[model samples]
Target: MSIKALITHIQELVSAQSGLAGLNLGLVNYGVPTKLPAIYIDGLTFLDDKLNSHTFNLCYVTTDLSIEQLDYAKLILAALQGSPCVQAQQLLPRPEPENKRNRWIIPCVFFPRALKA
Candidate 1:
């Protein structure tokens, strides 16, 4: 399946599992209204697994309330990783800007992989 299709499926799965209605899981933040207690998942990428030729990298950004909520989000991400659609999963920290000092910035991507051709 294509990476776009895979991402859509992952978003659907997450929404269904988290009981979130009308969640928009797109690459760009287009002012989607999210209810509190909802988790935001983004920055999904697929890359070559450098250590293993047979596998690929599935990286994404997960942001939520607290550490516990982040853990839950990770669990949800882990479940998605187990699917055949994904080769492997890696949890990457979203990079913070050097100047702007907002410690509570929602997770985002610094370096993202290009879509496979």
Candidate 2:
């Protein structure tokens, strides 16, 4: 799938989740927002020369200091795993936020039909 399509898929998945309705979601270029519980499309990488295999990051930030951060990651994984295009997904190390927020990135890979062969 294309990058735009992948982004749309992520958005749809997040929206369909149980408790993410009020969360602030955006793209990486939008910069660090003042809102809590935010998600961004941080980065995208093509794993192959043909762009058929791709990996992207879901950057999630929140002010809550508890393990609630993991819920978002799990929700993302659950949604992505249902798609045929998705090959794998992983959670990266939690990064120190600029302020008093918890930040993490969920990386996911997609192998389009062209590369499924």
Q: Find the candidate with the highest lDDT and give its number.
A: 2
Each candidate's root-mean-square deviation in Å?
Answer: 8.3, 4.0
What is each predicted model's overall lDDT from 0 to 1? 0.38, 0.64
Runs off by more than 4 Å, candidate 2: 22-36, 95-98, 114-117
Candidate 1 lDDT, 1-117, residue by residue in tens:
244454455455565554223333343222222433333334443343452222222332333323543454465555555444443344544433453211122322211132223
What are the clash counts of all predictions, listed in order? 0, 0
TM-score of each: 0.39, 0.69
> Which residue pairs in model 1 clash with each other?
none
Per-residue error for 33 in candidate 1, Å, reads 11
Error of 2 at 52 (Å): 1.4
Tens digit of per-residue lDDT, candidate 2, span 5-77 = 6656666766777766555554432245556577666556665648667766667777776676677667756
